[model samples]
Target: MLFGIILAYVSVGSVLIPLVLASFNWQNRSFEIRGLSILLLTSLICDASSMLLSRYHINTMPIVNFYLFAQFVILYLLFMRKLEIKNFLRVLLVLFCILCLIDISVFQGPYVLDTFSHIVGNLILMALSLYYFYTLLKELPTTYIHRLPFVWISFAALAYYSGNFFLFLLNNYLLKEAGSIAWMLHNGLNITKNVFFAIALWQAYHNRKLST
Candidate 1:
């Protein structure tokens, strides 16, 4: 069940990225934005591939490597951009990444550690996401139409990631039946993400004034 949910979530994101890109093709190329989009899309693809490989009881090392690479690229692009980067936010994000790595590695032994790590990661991610949204929302009222797509995309990312984090954290307690509740959370998050992406695509096209 966990595998299935993860697979679906990634697959939906994969499809939505292209659709959103096509909708906004007229905008002047912004490497930072494009790179971010590609990073996310690639990550989703890698994630989906990993899930499929695991489900088939096949070696998933390659997929995991790809996902890690995609994550690095995303981080690189995020840091390279000359946009505003609050010191506190930067520190928090770095710590969050470190925690994620530790959670994935050292916490893989017993279910207790696994559950604790999951909860911690989810809490940190949720806090970070909320901060991001608050900042973005503050700027939205003064932005132009072309910028709305970017804002909406960020919103979608926040929602999807937050949903997954919460679901995973809750699954540890609410659904202790290994793969049962985890699967449901996985599928639920995917469905929510796809819906957000669909809305984002529509908004992008609308902003473009594209004729159907």
Candidate 2:
């Protein structure tokens, strides 16, 4: 039942966000904002794929690997290139991707290493997200401060990553019920993130239309 709630929140959030953003008057017109809208849409698609894998009890290695790779690429293109702090993150993501690939290809046993790698990858992603939000808030127009997408997206990221990090660290220590609780929180975070991104995209679109 809890798992169902997790899936519903994450899946619905992913689908609704892009649609809402694209429907907005402001987003449909501007090429730049439209590009970002598309990017988020793509991310949601990848996220759905990962969720599907989880639902079917399939091996999630390929799905997770591809998702992480896509995230790294998107962050690099959209946010990392402009910032100095992202240098380490870029390197870490590249290395992490390579490691995941190698692990699936070379190692046959011992899932512990994969768990470690995932923790590191999540940590790096969280760091990048923080930096991205910080930069967005710092540079966004003062007039739009209240309207900025990062407001929700940042909080979502924080919740998602923090839960993930805690879960990973306590996996061995926590009971099965505790693990389930952590997963619920993680899914909740994802839902929040998707919803926030959608709202931001719509807001951006609206702002763009008003300007033009």
Candidate 3:
């Protein structure tokens, strides 16, 4: 019962926290911040809708599939904007969509988790997040590293996906073994990520105010 609450409404609420935080000074935020805002908003819609649909006997896999691609695009663009990457990301996005379709339509089951597409997305985003971290470490882009918005945002993604990597890989087995403990950890991590995202939004908003 507690697990059900956490996985359902609590998880959805996590996304909403940062999203509402980001909404303040929406137009004044940088492109990177806006990208994060959009990501959180996407998450809010998908999670809430997915939960609602599930209660009504809907499949919800289609939303999950859409979310994977949309998640990739926003995060891909966010880092590309920051890391100054080139056109290759667009190519990768297209290829990823194809992979997702094939994975969903052919390989994945109706209610089974889409592990393949998730694993692929996690690896790519993790690589990008690490690369962004590498640049931050080498360049020392700001005097106060801890307060940097993207730093927090990058760390949020890194923390969530890196922790999620093995959980996702072991999800099927864990379902049979550990029960909801694995996914409970997942929901906890997701909530942590959103809290950091809210912190990042605060940093951005404060920095923007100081600048002007």
Q: lDDT tens string, model 2, 134-201?
A: 77768865675646544544455556566667876766565545756666665666666667666767
Clashing pairs in 3: none
Clashes of 3: 0
Model 3: lDDT equals 0.81
Best by lDDT: 3
Ranked candidates (lDDT, high to low): 3, 2, 1
TM-score of each: 0.62, 0.69, 0.89
lDDT of 3 by residue, 154-173 (tens): 88889888878878766655
Give the CA lDDT, 0 to 100, for residue 191 in model 3: 87
Greater TM-score among 2 and 3 belongs to 3
What ranges in model 2 sit over 4 Å off? 2-14, 23-40, 43-61, 85-90, 107-113, 133-143, 150-153, 176-179
Per-residue accuracy of model 1 over 22-124 as CA lDDT, tens digit each: 4475463455445545655775676667668778987765465445435443533443342355676567657756765676667553222244444554455
TM accuracy, model 1: 0.62
Candidate 2 CA-lDDT value: 0.61
